[model samples]
Target: MIKLLVVDDSPLMRRLLTEIFSAAGDFEVAVARTGAEALDLLTAFAPDVVTLDIHMPGMDGLACLDQIMLIRPCPVVMVSSLTAEGADETLEAMALGAVDFIAKPRGAVSLEIDALAPELVDKVRQAASARISRATRLRERVRARTGGAMARPVPRPRAAQRISVPRGPLPADGLVLVGCSTGGPPALDALLGRLAADFPWPIVVAQHMPASFTGPLARRLDRLCALGVSEVVKATPLHPGQVYIARGDADILITRRAGLLTAIAAPSDPELYWHPSVDRLVSSAMAQVAPESLVGVLMTGMGADGARAMTELRTRGGHTIAESVDTAVVWGMPGALVAADGASVVAPLDRIAGELMALFKA
Candidate 1:
């Protein structure tokens, strides 16, 4: 069974979450009334995942997350009201290594808390064994923070120094490939929004999200970017001016036949380490796209899925990029790529959009 910890200030909420998660026999739920109490239980219990409330009475969710990273690192899901401030905090939480966020229900039904029981339980079960690494979260907590507008991209100096762009322009046919998870939804939306209607070539992305989430995410990004963004339908023909997201329970793969690139949605077996394994996508990409035709971009999330594949891509003479740490909601994915020297250009989020545009044109 996967052990879970629910941390919230309200006694009722703690109980509510517990009752919801308890229905899943696979999850063993534990409750912490506050961050302080949660920390104590975490050291003792070593739970698999944590669902946190952003606005707690004493320490607040962000402060608690910082402390939790230092004391004990675990997959965290932030639960907050769907207000502007809540949105801002959720983003901040992601930047600090929180895996994902959920908007608290706001209705008479929500007063029962149990009204959200079914969805809450499903999320908890799916998040079982979130692959967060202790060292990564520790690093985020140690970093200093400066306030800024919510939309402004955070700078990552370390990653900038880590990358070395090529001396001249890249190949004209380079296709940009990106992969992300955890806090990728809003970030991906922001990323796709900056592109022009004529982005020159195809943009493909693989995000580790459930089936229910991907379609909504695609629609959201579709509304945000000039480029068409939609959920991947199996055997769909790859096209430019359009982007596709890999649905849950499968890691998307690209196949080439007669010079036609196609998207293949392969069913995921839990036996594999990660559900939407970065290795699956990256390795498949390395094989499908010729060395002269592809550029890989690795972004934020936990685990080392893209690490080896990024190295392989670079070894195959393909250009590669890693999202700088500061801009990442969680630095694991990009951090792994950087550590292995897989990135051709390490850039902040804001610069990545502009850089990608220029790359496709070259």
Candidate 2:
């Protein structure tokens, strides 16, 4: 059985969570109403995973997360609401080492809450298999950035010098396609931040995120990276020096027209689990462009969504890169791609930026 610690201040939430896990038949849950209580149970419970609530009385979820990571360091799935504030806090929690999260239904304990049971159970199972990133790096960075204070909000991403792409023909260098999930946000922030303002090829990213968060993530990336970032709009013409984020609620397709690529955001196939499915994106790119003119990158994520497509791209002479296990927060996605002979190169997190640059130069 997967040992789980459920940390929520609301009694109703705690009960609902326990009932949900109990019905799942594989989880042994121990509930905590506060962060302090959760810490006390850590030694006795020895949970394989934890579901933490963001709003608790004393020592709120973030503070509790910091402490838990400092001490035990296990996979933690954050329980969050669907509001903007909830999304922001959830992103911050992920940066601080939480593995994943599930949005809570509106009512505390109603029919709506019951509807979320399956999703909660599914996410908990995913969390169980997730690899927790090293928190010390993030902790130290936070300390340095905040002058050793731990109470401040996550710092806003620095604004980048925006570059306006001219209305003209696409560059001859080709296109870059990136696919990621789970721990993708920070990884992308780091990878894209390393590019120069004149990055010659158009870049498209398929990141598994909610609709509300995608816009904020794109804006944040635009502020931090040299490339101008925008959420994909249907029929929008793509250009060099710009990074397009696939719409979170839809699958985005790249189409070739007049020597330029245009992004078409349309309703995703309901059967697919991941919105903006990476496989769909890569498959579309392969259809529109010569395989040799593609560069496919598979980063940290939970599943093999893009592995097959990436392999196909590589077989057709496209350059493919996978993030190495040592640096990926979760090695499943990239590892699957690498194992399938999809990647032309495997690089660590810090080196991916340089590797991509070198590939572009070549």
Candidate 3:
């Protein structure tokens, strides 16, 4: 059974969450009314996973999350509202080491909660299996405490050091296609921060998120990355040094507008399980551009959204990179690609940008 701790200030929310998880049969649930209570139970209860609400009374969810990471780094799933502010806070929580988040239903909490039960249970289950690196969390905490002076260098993975991809000059109009879910925000930050502003290819990302969250996510990435980042809300022409984040709740399709490569937001395909579907993105790009001119990257996400399409991309001479299990918070997406024999390179998150730079070298 999975041991889950549900932290929320609302008695209704706590009860609802407890009932939902308890009904799921495999979960042993515990509830806390405030952040302090949650922290108090952290050591004694020793949960495998935690579901945290952002609006707690005293210490608040973010503060509690910090304490949790510092005290005992276990997988955490944030329970967030479906508003703009909630999106920002949830993204911040993810950066601070949350495994995933479930957006709370809007209006009439009691009535809406039942509908959200399945998703909440599933995210919690996924979080229970997520990877949490205690050393990395502690290093981050130490660096923050010392303001970077006492920070220690992290050793690069041996696999990253020995990356041996064929050196070549990619086409002038080449594009990089990235797909991720679950623990994607931080991974994207790490990957995009490594690329220079003069990167040759325009990059597009299809991250599974809600419509309200992707805009804030794009804005956040724009501030952190050297590359210009924006959410594709319309038919935007692709340009080098720009990263286009697919609008959530919809799919971003690659097409040519008057001979210029463009990305347009389209209605979500009902057949696909995840919105901003990565499979659809790669498949659509392949229709307009040669597979060899595209590079597919499958990062830390749950499920096999991009595996088959990326495998086809590889068969037709394209390059594909999968985030290695050692670094991925959830090894589902990239692991799927690796399982299908689709990845041209399977590297840790820290080494992905280096591999991309190597592939695009002139």
Please report the candidate that would top TM-score against the real structure: 3
Kindly indicate the candidate among 1 and 2 with the higher lDDT: 2
Which candidate comes out best when scored by lDDT?
3
* Per-residue lDDT of model 3, residues 1-362, tens digit only: 99999999888888888989999999999999989999899989999999999987779998999899988999999989888999999988887778799988889989998998887888889889999998766654554444334523554754653333563677777899999998998889778878889998999999999999999999988977789999999999999999999999999999999999999999999999998999999999999999889999999999999999999999898889999998899999999999999998899988899889988664
Give each model's clash number.
Answer: 1, 0, 0
The order by descending TM-score is 3, 2, 1
lDDT of each: 0.72, 0.80, 0.89
Query: After aligning candidate 3 to the native by TM-score, how far in Å is the CA of 355 from where it should be?
Result: 0.3
Q: Could you tell me the lDDT of residue 265 within candidate 1? A: 83
| Stretches > 4 Å off in candidate 3 | 138-155, 161-167
* TM-score for each of the candidates: 0.63, 0.86, 0.95
The sequence of per-residue lDDT tens digits that candidate 2 reaches over residues 69-118 is 87788888898887778877877777677878888887645678778787
